[model samples]
Target chain A: MEFNASLIGQAITFAILVWFTMKFVWPPLTRMMDERAARIADGLAAADRAKQDLANAEKASADRLREAKQQAAELIAQAEKRAAQIVDEAKDQAKVEGDRLVKGAQSEIEQQVQSAREVLRQQVADLAVAGAEKILKQEIDAARHADLLASIKAEL
Target chain B: MAAEQSATDYIVHHLTHAGLVPKTGAIFNFSNMHLDTFWVALALGFLFAGLFGYVARKATSGVPGRLQNFVELIVEMVDTQIKDAFHGKSRVIGPLALTIFVWVFLMNAMDFLPVDLLPAIAQAIGYYGFGHDPHHVYLRVVPTADVNQTFALSLSVLIIIIGFSIKAKGLLGWFKELLTAPFHAEGLGMQIVLGPVNLAFQIIELLAKPISLSLRLFGNMYAGELIFILIALLPWWINWVLGTPWAIFHILVVTLQAFVFMMLTIVYLSMAVEDH
Candidate 1:
């Protein structure tokens, strides 16, 4: 129980052990724990970011899909309107051509009628002259009947 | 009556240390060293270093192994006590506290071994292997039971306290504190008159820390060791009857003493570093 050099030896040993533990053992272990904590935190943050990114991408794609659908509907409506306008123009051109053809045909009929009427008038004049010649018995005063012929023509 | 005589002789023989004998038959010699206490303490210290060193080497940032968990538990326990007791910043106190707790606990735990086991082996080795008479081979395995070992540990703590006090307060500040604390006087005459009283009180207070710290552990362990020895004096059949109960009870004493020693050391160091 008495004090001796062994006490000094143990003290020195204690000091060395404390120094060794402080220098070698403590720092790395504590650093490992701290590093593990940091890694877990980073992983959680990255997961959160990835989740947010996925949501954003989904939203963007959905918006794009909606816009594309709206554009397609607009394009179909425009095509239908253009088709209706083309059909209307074709109908109007058909109506105008029919009207012109009808007018031309009417004009041709009137010309033919006028021509026939002239021919008829010529034949009638010949017959009337012959009867007059027979009735008057001679080539008397033909020049004097010219005014009647003209009046007959004006009446026709 | 012969059995009782032998039992008294047995307890006295076991109490004696295995060390150098002074020629004058005097037991108190400054040069004397307890070889058994020395060897056991060194072996346990190596064991502490080896186990902690292995864990330190294999330590990872990933999931820990069983050994790593156990080592970390001890480390954390000591670290918590240090954090609680020591408010000031220090690099040394944490490891120092850990070492003291583990080393002293291991030393005290040596008492749990059957009181006769190591000594009997040492006696056999002495008689057969070394050709020494068994009667001359005396060994005491529990190191903390020895006043010298416990005092040595407490003295080291005292030294650290003094070193930290000087480092934190400066030499002049420490000196002034010693001479003028627990009572203050402004005038030169009053200061001069109060200096010796303050110095005496401070010295006593400083001296009491190591003494109480060492004696508390030594007294508990030495008494426990004695009781174990006394229990061992019973006949073989009755030995277990008393021995088992005492051994179980001594476990708390052993662990508590170590904890108390470590806590007091941290408290002392904290006091040394903090301003008055």
Candidate 2:
């Protein structure tokens, strides 16, 4: 049997191609893929960081809103307390003023009454003295006149 | 009687590999030696590597020359093919894809060399130097034309795929995948039939890998070599006229075969990663 040289030659060459290509070719190829994987991981980390930042912002905003709401309530309560205090002070001042006005009116009325009484007493005395002088044209006892005046005053 | 005996003898000899016949098992058959496979593949590998290096070194980064642009284009093509075929976290497949493309391309490109060039040179070297007969020297440059070489490549790819399958999915998990994947059917009766059917499909699929891989390469290269040999048989002057045209056209054929082989490898690796 004549075995062809071509078949033998072709077979030998193919084996080497497989050997070197596997050794040299596959390593660097895998490296590039690893780099790509690292890039994806970095991307995922960035996404995670962004999510965390968003959550932090949300929490911060909620805290601020709660604080603002609490302050608003406190401000409303303060305003109510101040208004009540002002109203109570005004009412107390009004009561004191009314009491003072009443006291002043009473004192003024007493003074006027005292002055009128004194004037009336002086007029009655003058009228009594004039009548006694007319009746007593002739000489009369001063003691007897005084006693009669006292009796008239007591009877009136 | 002599004619029938010669014909039978020819078929048996044709089947025998030109190697150091070993006296042992498949693993111990290191006696099957094929040196031309190494030499031609090495020669072409150096030739391609040199060409790429020379072109790249001479490139002006500002605006690439035609050769530089062409090299970049080839790289991009290889890279894009890699991206399309493999998925998830792969740290080894990209450069493997490129190397596969370049190595096979170089091997295939050997077909463009006058089918007689290396053999002619070997004959000359011996005829003049050692005074050995020119008729004794024989060499074939293309590797894929050899079925053994193609099968070797397929077997290597098979091992890698199996290795990754084991690595990505543990041994137990991978085995479980065979039992349960692609929709589960309940009950003892269904399991009895479907399990073996599924196992058989898996086996067939695995077997097809080397068969298809080897055959595809072998068919293309064997045809190309046959055509070149037929062309060489024409009158010497006429040989150049017809052979040169085919040689130029075959540049495309060789490159396409290499591309196909590499793409298929990537596809196989992609499949290995999938659960089904």
Candidate 3:
């Protein structure tokens, strides 16, 4: 239990050890631990951000899908209306064409009937003149009877 | 070996240190070196610093290895203690506390070794290699068992505490506080009368820190070592009956003493830096 040189010796050794620890041991380990803590915090923050982004993206996609569905429904309704309009126009055009064709056929038939009547009238007139000539047996002057033939033609 | 000597001689032999003996008329001379205490303490100090230094060099911010994890556990424990007790910013306290805790712990752990193992080896070496008597080669492996070693550390802490106090409050301020504190007076006459008393109390308080710090650790380790030696003197078969339980209980003492020393040093430093 004597105080001796070992006291000084141990003190020197103790000082050296403390110095070594302060210089080389404490700082690096402490820094690494702090750095690790910061890194973990950053990682957690990033994960939270990713989660938020994912939720936002999902909402955006859902909104776009709803808009697309709405647009598709509007387009279908417009196409159906256009198809009905086309069918109505076709029916109207077909009715107008049929009316024009019927009018033309009626007019043509009237003109042909008038021409046939004229032909028949002219033939009857010629037959009557021939009968009169046979019955008379005497030669009549044709140039002088022009007015009478015209009257007879008109009566027939 | 024990059959020849009395129990007293065996216990005294175990307590004796292998070192340079003091010369005549010089009981407390520096020439008297406790070689065992110095060497063992030096070795343990290096072991503590070197291992920590190596681990600190290789330490990473990423996932740590097993050794790194274990080292970090201890370093963090000490760091937390410092942060909790020490509010002032000083770079020295952290490492100092760590060194004290780990070095003292390792030194105290020397109690776990069989009491006669190191001494027997030293005896064999001295007998075969140096032609000395086997019983004369005394070696105590536990450095903390030595008052000199414990005092050396505590004295160093005391010096650091004084340095901190002076740094915090200048020398004049510190002296002024020493004379004025723990007994503030209302007037000049009361102050004059109380100043010396306060100064006396302050000196005793200052002296008490190192004394208590050194003696606590030294007493625990020394007593534990003595008990182990006494247990070793018992019959070989019965050794485990007492040895195992004592060793188990000593584990607590060893770690607790180290923790107490470190805590006290930090507390003292913190107290030094604060005004009364």
Tens digits of per-residue lDDT, candidate 1, A24-88, equal 77766666667777988999999999999999999999999999999999999999999999999
* Pairs of residues at least 3 apart in sequence or in different chains that clash in candidate 3: none
Best by DockQ: 3
Model 2, B1-276: lDDT tens per residue?
Answer: 113335443333222332444213353344365456656666766766566546544544344567766766776687778777788467556555665678777777778777657766766886898897554444556766766566766776777777778788899877776766554679878876677677777767777986797689878887887688667656676778889888888888898888888899889888888777
Against the true structure, whose lDDT is highest? 3
Query: Which lDDT value does model 1 have at A78?
Result: 100
> Can you list the residue pairs that collide in candidate 2?
A12-B37, A13-B37, A29-B95, A30-B91, A30-B92
Q: Model 1, residue B23: displacement in angstroms?
A: 9.0
My TM-score estimates for the predictions, one after another, are: 0.76, 0.57, 0.88
Tens-digit lDDT track of model 3 for B59-102: 99999999899999999999999989998999999999999999
lDDT of 3 by residue, A14-97 (tens): 999999998999999999999999999999999999999999999999999999999999999999999999999998888998
Off by over 4 Å in 2: A1-156, B1-30, B48-68, B181-184
lDDT of 1 at B252: 96
TM-score of the first chain of model 1:
0.68
Better of 1 and 2 by DockQ: 1
Lowest lDDT sum, 10 consecutive residues, model 1 chain B, at: B21-30
User: How does model 3 score by TM-score?
Assistant: 0.88
Compare candidates 1 and 3 on lDDT and give the better one: 3
- Every candidate's CA RMSD: 5.5, 13.9, 3.3
- Judge candidate 2 at residue A35 and give its lDDT: 56
Model 3 has a clash total of: 0
